[model samples]
Every structure is written in structure tokens, then in C-alpha cells.
Target: MAEEKAAENTAAQAAPQVQMRVLGQFIRDMSFENVMAQKGVSGDVQPEIAVQVNLDAKKRSAEHQYEVAIKLNLKSKAKGLEDILFLCEIDYCGLFHVEGVAEDQLHPFLLIECPRMLFPFLRRIVSDITRDGGYPPVNLDNIDFVALYRNELMRRQAEAQKTEA
Candidate 1:
């Protein structure tokens, strides 16, 4: 029994431990255009907003370092009219030092987990920008990273299938 216990301990020691750290985070690019102000349009504001999110991840030149970015696009318009309200676009990125994640899992970890860490900061920026832009603060809904990842995978698979056919 003692020998078996020792063997188990040795096996555990042989496995690599996972470590992840956020080295830094920042907005790579951002733009806010107040279309209503730009056009000098005046009317009752019943706003309908559309949001799109895209994520990208790439390994940095440094070992165990990766850069992940989230691109957010938002357009707001009056609910019943064709007049525009505002447009906001931002690309937020994080620098991460990651080690010990399996090769197969690294891509998902970078896209999903890194974004989850950086989202609150990005959300705050969006809220501030909207409020300062003369519109009500737009508090973003919480993103579902896992669902996003799965959907992206499904999209890629469908595209590949279309290409092959």
C-alpha cells in the first residue's frame, strides 16, 4: 500500500501544473460616432441597438505569451425610424503569460478565458463612452464565452463543409 501511494505521488509530480497570468490589458482601438449629433437630427429617441462581437487570439513571439483581442461593434438607431443614433467600435486586447495548458486546449483558453478576464474593463469603457456621447449609458449584457466559442466552431465547420461541397 505504501509503494502504491508513492507511485501515485510520483505520477502526480510528473504532470505539468497550469499557470496563467495577465501581463497587461488595453484598448487597441476605439471609436464612437454620435450620428444624431453629426446629422443634427431631433426627434423622440426610442433606441434600438445591435451588437456584434468577434474574438481573435495569437501566440506572441515570447515563449508562453499570447495576445487575445475582442472586437465589439454596436449600432443604435431609432426604433421606428431609419435615423441613426450612435455607433461604437472597440478592440480590446490582453497580454497573457500562460503555461502548462495542453496544446489542444490553448486556443479555447485564449479565446474564452482571457476575454472573460478582460470583459469588465471593456464594459466600463463602453458605458462611459455612451454616457459621455450624450446617450444613456449602455450597460452591456454579460457575454457567454462558452456559447460564443461553440458557435464559432459551428460556423467554421459549416463554412468548411460549404467549401468542400
Candidate 2:
């Protein structure tokens, strides 16, 4: 009976209608700037950027939905106070299928899975742009998308509470 139940559970999980997921991806936008940086660094420019990554996710359609786009903007500077070393904007997009998936599962697919897949590519682009712009390669630390999403939720909740108060 236990073996039969396990088989039944596996069959249920294997159903095509029960799984919704992101499939493939393409780049929507990528831009890099460094003219000011070239002159302003005044030295090797060993850049230290105040990196602020803001992530946004949405479903583009109704059917097996899309995880939508991941946008990253980086503004770099040399020393503590200096002109813009460079500003890079990377927009990474992916195909996501969400039909038959719970809203809870879908949420992580967008915030975690989609970005996780795109992050390495985004990081590479950022590094290459910086290197090509005549600076040392920019290496970014790993991002925790789950934590970011949770913080975004808490921030929205706080704003809602503030409005209520």
C-alpha cells in the first residue's frame, strides 16, 4: 500500500499540467557608459562603486506566463567623491510558464529562478564593459534574490501600514 501510494504521488507530480516554469531568455537592453570615467579616474581608477540593485518582476500574459524582465543599473565612482566612473544598465529577460502553478510557486519563479539564470550573464556583461572601458574588471558578489524579494515585501507592507496610519 505504501509503495502504491508513493507511485501514485510520483504520477501526480509527473503530470504536465501540474508544472509551470520559465523556459528560455533573450536580452532586451544593454548599455554602458564610461567617457567621464576615462578622464576622471586620473589614476588606475581602481573603482569602487556604490552598487544598488533593484529587481522588478511581472507576468506578461495569462497563459503559461512569463517571468518578465530583470533590470540592473550600476553607477561606479573612484575614491569617495568623483565623477561617474561608469553607468551600466542591463535588462535581462526570460520566458516563463506559470499555468497550473500556485501563485506562491510562481512568485519565486520570477524573483529567484528567472534572475538566477540571468545573473551570470549580467555579471559577465558588467565585467566586460568595465574592462573594455579601460578599467579593471568589475566583479560583483553573489546576489540573494529570495532575500531581496522578501525585503521588498516587507518594505511594501511598511508603506501600506504607514498609509493606513
Candidate 3:
């Protein structure tokens, strides 16, 4: 019995206990506008589209819970036309249970992995909203969170260097 108990404890220690789960998802804020609805849908005009994405995370409680938010802003306008075609902004958030992540790894896991997990649902909401607003679905491309994180780090470094100089 002593040997068995020792073996079990050893196995438990050797195995990394990591758990990540999405507890809930919600749209904190959403806005959709079709500014030129009166002008009607113009098939010939190819509008310019701009999209921006940002991620933020915060600790919800002491029990290894986190809330991650993904913000998406989209704007569309015709090249020559003065009126805007459409605008969409959404702040989508997810409550997550994260455990067994090292302190150094926590930032990346929250920013990259948590957002990656929530992205598909957020994308779907954007698409559906756009389509319902009388425009074609604005399909969002898959985000490269790793690249984004690196770029953010570089930007911060540049800013720090500028301040020091």
C-alpha cells in the first residue's frame, strides 16, 4: 500500500496538470450601421474595407479564471462616394478557466490561445451581422496572434528606446 501510494504521487507530479475551458461567451458591445441604405445597394461600386482587431485579458477572480475580450472594428466606404457604406464594431468576450500555466507563459496563453479559441465565434457573429445589415458577409481572415504579439513587443521596445533617448 505504501509503494502504491508513492507511485501514484510520483505519477501525478510528473504529469502536467493543465486545464483550459471556455466558461461563457458574450458580446459586450456591438454596433452596425448601413449609412447609405437610402442609396440602395450598388453592385458596381467596390467599397474599400478596413478591419482592426485587438485582444485584452483580465483576471476575473482568485480561482484561476480569466476574461478575454476581442474587439473588432470594420468600416466600408466607396472610393468616390462621400457617404459611408457600412460600419461594424463589436467587443466580444469570453470567460475562461485557466490552470497550471506558469507565470511567464500566462500572458501569451491569454492573449494568443484564448483569443484564438474565441475567434471563430466572433468571426461568425461579425459575418452574420454584416449579412443581416444588407451587405455581403465580411469574412475575416485567420489571425496570426504570434506575429501580432511579436509586432506589439517590437513597438513597445521602440517606444521605450525613444523615451530613453
- C-alpha root-mean-square deviation, each candidate: 1.8, 3.0, 4.1
Candidate 1 lDDT over residue span 77-128, tens digit each: 8998888899999999999999999999999999999999999999999999
lDDT (C-alpha, whole model) for all candidates? 0.95, 0.75, 0.90
Per-residue lDDT tens digits of candidate 2, residues 52-154? Answer: 7776677666666675677878887766667677888878787776566566677766677678877887788788888897777888888998998889889
Q: Which residue pairs collide in model 3, if any? A: none
Off by over 4 Å in 2: 1-22, 37-41
Residue 80 displacement in candidate 1 (angstroms): 1.9
How much is the lDDT of residue 135 in candidate 3? Answer: 77
Instruction: Name the TM-score of candidate 1.
Output: 0.92
Candidate 1: where is the Cα deviation over 4 Å? Answer: 1-11
State model 3's lDDT. Answer: 0.90
lDDT of 3 by residue, 64-144 (tens): 999999999998998877668998999999999998888899998999999999999998998899899887788899999
Candidate 2 global TM-score: 0.80
Output the better candidate (1/3) by lDDT. 1
Residue 78: error of model 1 in Å?
Answer: 1.0
Between 2 and 3, whose lDDT is larger? 3
